[model samples]
Structures are given as structure tokens and as C-alpha cells.
Target: MKKEEVPQDESCFSDTEMKEVIYAVDKDGKYDKALSSGWETKTIVLDKSLEHIEERKAQAIANIKNGIQSPIAYFMEEHRMDIPTLASYVGIWQWRVKRHLKAKPFQRLSAKTLQRYAEVFEISVSELKHPKF
Candidate 1:
């Protein structure tokens, strides 16, 4: 978007947080590097992306509470992961990871398997089994 169209609001990135990029050549032919030149729209896009993530997080929490899924599903959403992604991280098959997303299979997981998931999620095995959220 044009610099004139960028919204100046609380959600916009502050001066300190804005990233700089080269957008044009200066009169002397050096690159013109400034955050204000080309990256304003990126901030707006990032804010919207974060909103989507929050929405997914809320849905995951609701799924956990309703017992339609397990805490693994919730933490997967929290970590921005899918079954395949989590499977790769935990060194398991995608189908096994999908099984772990169910309460019954999750409860049946051995401590060693739970430890792999916990290590991938950067949490303790107990937290993986019984997330506070």
C-alpha cells in the first residue's frame, strides 16, 4: 500500500519495532533504506495474522474443554503445528500423532512417548498430559 494509506493506530508497529528495507535509489544512487518506505503494509498484515492465530487458539481451548479432543490438540494449536508437523518433531508417524490427539490414546501413551512430545513442545510431560489451559 502507499505510505499515505498506512493506518496510524495502536496496532501498528511502533518506530522501534518496525523493520527497514531498501526501497529505492537515493539521488546519489545509494539504496534508500527505511522502514517507512515499503514495510507499512507488512505490519498490518502481521497484525491480522496474529488475530487469526488467537482465533485458532480459542477454538483449540474450546475443543479441549468439550472433550472432543485432547490437550495435545490444544498445544499443537498453541505451537502453530499440525499433526504432520508434530509427528516430525516427535519422531512419530502422522497417524500416531493423530491418535495422540484423542483423549483415550493420549492417556494410553507411555511416559517415553509423552516425553518426546513434551520435548518438542518445550513443556514437562505432566504439563503435556494435563495442561493448565
Candidate 2:
């Protein structure tokens, strides 16, 4: 985008936070330097991303409450992980991780398997099985 379109607002960032942006410094467009400042456009994009995450969290909570899925799904979102990523972390296959996201399958999981998930989430098995929120 053009320099004119770049946002100069700092409302989304704190006084201590800053973003580095490279800009052309010469008419020949060969020189560049990093300017430390907040970009409103970046802030807007970050806000939208956070909003999307919140929406997903709400849906995960709803699914858990309705007994359509397990708390593992919620923890997955909380950790910003997809099935494959979580499976890799837990040293399991993606399909098995997906199965663990289901309420029935998760309920039948062995303690050893639950420990794997709990360790990845940095929580206890009890907390993993019954999340507070």
C-alpha cells in the first residue's frame, strides 16, 4: 500500500509497545530504514484476529456444554493449535487427536493418554478433563 494509506495512529498499542516498519528513504527507492511506531492498520488486523479467536472459543465452549465435543477442543483453541499441530505435540496421529476431541472418545481415553494432552496444555489431568471456563 501507499504511504498515505499507512495508519499513523497508536491507540491500539501501549506506550511501551512499538512496531518496526521499513520505508523508502530516497527518491531512487534504494534506501530503507526501520521506523519504530504503531500502525493502525496492523492494530485493526490484530483486533480482528483476536475477535475471531474469541468467537472460536465461544463456539468451542458451546460445543462442550452441549456435549457434542470435549474440553480438549477448547484447550486446543486456547493453545492456538490445530489437530495436526496438537497431535505432533502429543506424539500421536492427527486422526487420533481428532477422535480425542469428541466427547465419547475423550471420555473413554486412558489416563496415560489424558496425561499426554494435559502435559501439552501445561495443566493437570483433572483440569484437562474439567476446565473451569
Please give the CA lDDT of all the candidate structures.
Answer: 0.76, 0.84
lDDT of 1: 0.76
| Per-candidate RMSD, Å | 3.7, 2.5
Residue pairs whose backbone atoms clash in candidate 1: none
Judged by lDDT, which candidate is best? 2
Candidate no. 2 TM-score: 0.85
Which digits, one per residue and each the tens of the lDDT, describe model 2 over residues 17-114?
Answer: 66668674454545555454676777789989888888898999999999999999999999888788999999999998899998999999999999
Cα deviation at 30, candidate 1, in Å, is 6.8
Question: Model 1 TM-score?
Answer: 0.76
Instruction: Encode model 1's per-residue lDDT on 16-44: one tens digit a residue.
Output: 57644435555565555434423446757
**TM-score per candidate, chains pooled:** 0.76, 0.85
